[model samples]
Target: MAMQLPTCTGIRIRSMSDAHVIFHAVTLGILPIVSRRLDIEERRYIHSGCVCVWEERSAAGEGSSVTGIERWTDGRRWGPSRVRDEFLYYQEKLPEFEADEELSALIFGSRLIKQTYSVFVDTPTGRRKWHLGTSVRLRARARFYLTLICMAS
Candidate 1:
């Protein structure tokens, strides 16, 4: 399925539902940054609401289906200069920690949507990494949290 996004410059991604786990692993995998890298005195709010996903059958009689996920502007319209500034800040700070090219690209290029920072991750079998143990652990943790929420409610 196709989704129209807001008219703003920023990063957009198309990946499986488990993308957040990858982000979490990457963020916690490295040492924390003691100093803030952003120069903006005001904290820009990040709001993600518009999300769409659907399946499209391949026309080649392959019976294949593809899913798309996208997240738009972080609630604020950052101008060109601001986008560049954020990109540079991350670029400078990324080296302080250990991150692979894919992670770095996702983080640094997250603010240059104008013909840049486009990432496509394939989730099909054999195309992506599958950490079964980690996945199970995370699922158990999530279930525990959800159970707590349900009990509280």
Candidate 2:
């Protein structure tokens, strides 16, 4: 049988007191997310769109969804000139999305640093909501975080 973590529940990472194990698991998932996003940062040619894949752990939860915001061709070099133009292009469409009935957003930014300069927003309709990190990540994180909290309980 598989070894389970020792928590209140039957099987969960949180129950495991061993920091190394939990760290390994979380990192395994989060690292690729960071690396993949970093690659986009360098190219600066994001294929803007929405991904409608999210996991709902419970009945009452915000539901975390992964959405695409920006795309970069180069994997290691990008400057303000390119990123700025893209930022403006995406921000212009936010009001249009918010106006619709099937609308809500989840913002994403660089997981390495707490900067909100660029973001990836996830909408209910599976549209990629794009914006600056400080600009949108704050709002999106709140929704994702809340959903996570509810699911955990």
Candidate 3:
């Protein structure tokens, strides 16, 4: 059975504990793509975001929709560079993934694994949402940290 991590209910970047979960995950190299955005130090300051494991599917069963695992991000203060850097880093990481046929096939051959990020900014009219990046992790290493945090609350 696939292990299920605790879900994030209304999590945001303002929460220190929630942000730490992402930092810790990146520090451990749990999500190679996400980790590429940081220069070791920046990872420490990424204190506003929630991580979610999502499964994409198609209702028609035609295999036309995205499938497999995905990491979704909803954060505050994440900049364009952060997401852009990660996308570029994936290019370098692609070669290494060749060893894993399943992962390589899904990522290179098919578009199963994907990522979507959104940033929230505070404004006079409350929080404004900035939708960013439609694109496309780990063997639950990151999930473990998130699970702990979820269970605590």
lDDT of each: 0.29, 0.28, 0.35
Q: Compared with the true structure, what per-residue lDDT tens digits does model 2 show for residues 4-86?
A: 21111111111223323333443345312222233323324222221111121222333443333234222222222323322
Q: How close to the true structure is residue 21 of candidate 2, measured as C-alpha lDDT? A: 39
Q: Write the per-residue lDDT of candidate 3 for residues 16-135, one digit (tens) a residue.
A: 344446434533546322311223443333322224422322234434443423333322222233333223112113333435777665554432122344444333334333222222
Would you list the clashing residue pairs of candidate 3? 13-48, 114-136, 115-136
Any idea what lDDT model 2 has?
A: 0.28
- Give lDDT for model 3: 0.35
Q: Could you tell me which 10 consecutive residues in candidate 3 have the lowest summed lDDT?
A: 85-94
Task: lDDT for model 1, please.
Answer: 0.29
Q: Which model is ahead, 1 or 3, in terms of lDDT?
A: 3
**Superposed Cα deviation of residue 2, candidate 1 (Å):** 21
Off by over 4 Å in 1: 1-66, 81-120, 125-153
> What TM-score goes with each of the models?
0.20, 0.17, 0.20
